[model samples]
Target: MRYDGSNELHARQARAKLEKLIKDKKIFDLTEKKPQRSIQANKYLHVCLSYFGCQIGETMEYVKRNYYKILCNPDTFIREREDKYLGRVKYLRSSSELDSSEFSLTVDRFRNWCSSNAGVYIPSPDEERLIQLMELEIERNKEFI
Candidate 1:
């Protein structure tokens, strides 16, 4: 879920809750470190996603192109939240003030980039819906710009 909240307190509360979930290993399992055996990894790959530097499709491309690399060190494939918003948008403390009006445009651009240069056209049809999700995120952060 997006971490946008009404204020610092809300944000902190949300962060705490999310972090707690992480700490409790409810959101993601630590033992599932091996990408192949991990249901989360496969589910993550099977779904569309957008985070930081890599788009869902691009990530899939990276995995396709460098499966061995990812299998060798899964950390190399991990995407951080901060990397996604660094220069692209301003930091808004609350979700209410955010605007992602241009999210679709951004997604279109990223998709074009992915299709033309990233690799073979997203190999999996099941992934297109996941890529479309970038629109929501774009809308979520529209005001940040």
Candidate 2:
């Protein structure tokens, strides 16, 4: 989906510019005394890799192992992932005061709703409980998965 303030063309343009800078060594220049930039470089690479369909952890590992410029900035990788998923959806603005209670209730209702909607009542109570446990696990790990 497109973000409200950006389009594919703009993104492509930005990427192209970054590619040009990297190719020209402008981004890696360190002739004079310079502040450390390995972390920033790596984080930005992770963001780019993610947009190109790499998983966050995999992209992070690849950049860390291969890139001399980004070996230091671990926080950048995490923040990039956070920025991608949480884009434009700030928690302060999106969350309600009742969010904690509402979220738990929603999960419970969803579990019951799924069970009831199954074609037929499952014969074994243990089987039903297993299903509920699996569902809970799935719900809890949804974001990472």
lDDT of each: 0.40, 0.36
Residue pairs with clashing backbones, model 1: 48-130, 52-84, 99-142, 99-143, 100-138, 100-139, 100-142
TM-scores for every candidate against the unseen true structure: 0.22, 0.19
Instruction: Give the total clashing residue pairs for model 1.
Output: 7
lDDT of 2 by residue, 34-130 (tens): 2333543333333332321222233423433333123222222222224666665322211122233343343333234324653222112235564
**lDDT accuracy of residue 46 in candidate 2:** 35
Residue range 6-98, candidate 1, lDDT tens digits = 578768987787689988878543221111234433343333233322433245334333431233223332333455547443222321121
